[model samples]
Target: MPKSLAEVEEGRTVRIVDVVAGRGAAAMLYNLGLRPGARVEVIRSGPGPVVVRTEGGTFSIGRGLAFKVLVEEEE
Candidate 1:
């Protein structure tokens, strides 16, 4: 099942399914190398920013924004 980035477990890799954030937030994430089809590894998850690693680099997404990024586990 698809889950929000904020809900992904640490050490798991997931593919971005959709970003439900506002235009500004979505644009910001896009610039940060997060978008549909991008593969990201969850480095941390919980009551703080969600840290994810992508080919571009690592980034810490605020909890609110992280919840807006929907993802699915990669096979």
Candidate 2:
């Protein structure tokens, strides 16, 4: 059930399963708390940065960074 963040619809809860970390990608996602095993809820996307609400707070993860984080939709 793992899918790239770009494949996930906004307003759904997803569990972070993997990350394709790179220099910019790592810092972007890490700053937004998108590491493996982290639970994130996709809030709003498109025409702007993809937003994710997590334990710490609401964070806007850009599509470029979002694509690197693989997540499974929560049931």
Candidate 3:
């Protein structure tokens, strides 16, 4: 099932399914290499920002931004 990036736990790897943000936010994420089908490992997720690491690099996505990122857990 797809879930917001903010809801994923640390150490879990997920594949980005979609980004439910406006053009600007989506474009920002896209520039960070967080587009659909991109795989990322959650480094931290809680009250603060949701940190994720992908092939491109690590990113600290704010809670609001994290919620806009829909992802599915990787098997």
Per residue, candidate 3 scores C-alpha lDDT tens digits across 29-71 of: 9998999999999999889999999999999999999998999
Q: How much is the lDDT of residue 54 in candidate 1?
A: 99
Best by lDDT: 3
TM-score, every prediction: 0.96, 0.82, 0.97
| C-alpha lDDT (0 to 100) for residue 27 of candidate 3 | 96
Clashing pairs in 1: none
Candidate 1, 24: how far from true, in Å?
0.5
RMSD of 3: 0.6
Every candidate's CA RMSD: 0.7, 1.8, 0.6
Q: Give the 10-residue window scoring lowest on summed lDDT in candidate 2.
A: 25-34
* Pairs of colliding residues, candidate 3: none
**Candidate 2 regions with alpha-carbon error over 4 angstroms:** none
Per-candidate local distance difference test: 0.94, 0.81, 0.95
State the lDDT at 9 in candidate 1.
91
**Candidate 1 — worst ten consecutive residues by lDDT sum?**
24-33
Between candidates 1 and 2, the lDDT winner: 1
Cα deviation of 1 in candidate 1 (Å)?
Answer: 2.0
Candidate number of the best TM-score = 3
Ranking by TM-score: 3, 1, 2
